[model samples]
Target: MYHALLLLVQKLSYEVEEQIFSEVSLAIQKPESYFEMFKDRLDERGIDSPIDELAWISLVDSLLDHGLAFEIDWKESGLYICDVVDELLDRKNMACVSWEDFEDGEFDELPTSLCLNKISGKLKEQAISLASLDIESDCYVLITVPSSDTDEMKALAKEAGYSIQDSF
Candidate 1:
């Protein structure tokens, strides 16, 4: 069930922060790989027998909702417009949209960048400034979250990990 996945993320986050962060981070960055890794881990959890592509997508969504995870994504997310695609399609123009990113494999493309930005905007309206960190140094878009969360994520990547792992 979705609840089990959410609990697995939160309950094991601190105890297994390294693995947890890696899976959540990869869920968006490399879903195919993420799923391969996730399925293996899910099988280990004993949550479901032979765990074949469970509602892992919802698990990721729940993680963001609880501020337990953040995503690396495009910054020009504002440019994504479903209406334009719709109008183009109305004219019978050849076009294709993929929601495979979220695993539904349907619906319009909703980039994680736009979703994360909207989350930042909502936090700002509430006087909270979610930290935008540049662990990978792409210089285009930064991973957005608070210091602690980002710090954990930083430890998972080659460019972001601290030189001293014992401290992390």
Candidate 2:
């Protein structure tokens, strides 16, 4: 089974952090009401806010403000959202890689240095990506790599002056 991992490195203002937490908590606890409140926004984005997938939806919602969102198709293990900052949008320095990329063997085209696998854990041999690096406003970067590649990711993170804030 191939599982997906999500990682975020950013410093949030206390107000923004609190808002995200509260919104996500509400979405998780009362998905129906939460969906209703954000229905128009979600609809504008063409996302289906199903109550059963509250956890995933809430995560997506929380990150939406940061210009990040993941469209997860659970039944198919599909991840449809992959956004990278403009300058490094090529295959070599992609900010995000979609499920389609994996199915299409795109990872094989990456250099070995960029190819990362989890060093330990149930999620082994999974390909990872640096995803996004926002240095200007937030000094934030997002990584979607497997646990095995954590050391390499950490090294890169350190060089970039970002400490890991959250991982999933």
Candidate 3:
């Protein structure tokens, strides 16, 4: 099972994170339940019922593709709920950085590449992009990386002047 460490840097506020989760949950839940409602209709049509699970999973996968959901680690078990969020920060200028973007085909040396300087550079780049949008709000760099890289990620984040806000 693969897991991701959600590093919310810059503006560290639980309220913002919780609000994002709440809004996203409500948004996805509506469509998810709508799909679930089809089970009864299928049953009435003499088809195998209880397709709720599959339907819900499909809807969630679609949401993930559209950046409406974030993946977080769930110990060693592969079964886990994806983290849903409406936004990473209150500002519209926030940037999201995924660990996959840093991969250079050398899986063995991937961790070594996630160093302080590189991570900080990425953050700076994101900040600059936000600035161009006339956004003076605190810049945030959210990273979604595997659980195995949590510790190293934390260390690098600290070195990059970002405090660890939350991890799942």
Candidate 4:
């Protein structure tokens, strides 16, 4: 049930997130029926569902006024309902990909060779690309390197036809 809610909230749309947040804000006020509406919604989606497990959201030991975060093994990346929303609304260079779009399996490869950057260590540090929740507007995908490497990432993104967004 928690997993289903996680996947649903990972909807990642600003509008949807706002709706969920509004619903949560109201539901949290009730304390007892916090997840009742969520369960009903999930059950409705269970008919001919993509995956199994018609999860009954029982045992609400505590209130989840802030919403639940689930780290599922189904996908290698952890899905955060809030982080994705924040970056999408505030960041200009970032793109939002829906779970359904992912299911379609359409993809393109960037010029990854440009990711090879020789930072201070003089070691060839490779910046990888992925569908990430913890993302920034500086460049597409998650660049896990020092601040110095951001220039290289921006260069790579621009060279790859990705625009450097001045404002969102």
Candidate 5:
């Protein structure tokens, strides 16, 4: 059930991510109840991971408070969600994938073709894009790097003058 929820959240269309928060917020105002709703979902499935449920609840709250309305282009949002989901699944897999199966010693190695400088630059690009959006100062940036490379990426991110979230 937890896996299914993860998949559903991951499969959430980009527009849904952008719009559902507002819709849900307007549909339901009580933050405590909102949390309970998610907790209920997890409880219904007998999922034991409290942390995971809390993460989703927080994400929903953050989305609503920030006025993150979905972009109108269905195709674009759909594609964006797909990419986000894929990235998420990859990160999820990294937590379980064995080190021996990894070709390189470093599981966190940036794609060889994608230069580290470019990847770091892209984070800045995202930072800029996010600023153009309605995200608040307290809004957090969630980076899902390979589990093996999380520490290094996090350090690099900090060095680049960007704050990184340690947890979702």
Candidate 6:
């Protein structure tokens, strides 16, 4: 499943370069809305179904690869739907990953920005994969990845110049 998600992201990155795919921002901002809009356009209609819990979780993780996922704390008083966009688009705390903004990749080389999602409480390193990217402005997104420990990840994030909280 993780591999599949990685492939999807990589494919989407190429699609972006080719101008054949829709922008990542819209997809991350309103996944359900967009799904409803394009549900009929899909060739494999039988495989289409409402996103399940597992699917949403994985989708959120994939959004990170595009550097578009934001962590939300819904327990706060009087949370509203608008708050979701506010929390995610806030430039102060967001971590932007751009493949071109960092360095070019050779064959077998990893892109500077990568994404990994963990299920349960365990983080698996092999779940990580790089995005295939080109173009300078294509670098405007935030992403999350797997780490062994919360403290260690936090330290790494700090070193990388992002204000991300430790993921335990």
The residue pairs in collision within model 3 are none
lDDT digits (tens) for residues 52-156 of candidate 3: 233223322332333433333222111111011114222233445444544554432433223323443444444411101001123222333333444554554
Give one digit per residue, the lDDT tens place, for model 5 in 65-159: 33331211212222233243235335334222222333343423433222222333333332311111111233333233333444543444344
lDDT by residue (tens digit), candidate 6, 1-168? 333333333432322322222322334456566566545532232326444322323333344434444433323121221233233334224232222321222311322222111111112233322111111222322233433333443343344333233221
Tens-digit lDDT track for model 1 on 121-162? 443443333333232332222222332343444343223221
lDDT of 1: 0.37
Best by TM-score: 2
TM-scores for every predicted model? 0.23, 0.36, 0.22, 0.23, 0.26, 0.21
RMSD of 5: 14.9
User: Where does candidate 5 clash, by residue pair?
Assistant: none
lDDT of candidates 1 onward, in order: 0.37, 0.39, 0.32, 0.29, 0.35, 0.32
Query: Which residue runs of candidate 5 sit more than 4 Å off their true CA positions?
Result: 1-13, 17-19, 23-28, 41-56, 60-103, 107-168
Which parts of model 1 have CA positions greater than 4 angstroms off? 1-67, 79-121, 139-168
Error of 6 at 4 (Å): 13
Once fitted onto the true fold, the runs of candidate 6 whose alpha carbons sit more than 4 angstroms away are 1-12, 18-24, 42-49, 52-168
Badly placed stretches (over 4 Å) of model 3 are 1-11, 14-93, 96-101, 112-117, 128-168
- Candidate number with greatest lDDT: 2
lDDT accuracy of residue 164 in candidate 1: 11
lDDT of 2 by residue, 1-168 (tens): 001212222222122556666665666578788888788766754657654445334544565454442222212111112223122233223233233434455654543223322111112333433332222222223434434455654554455344332222
Candidate number with the higher lDDT (1 or 6): 1
| TM-score computed on alpha carbons, candidate 1 | 0.23
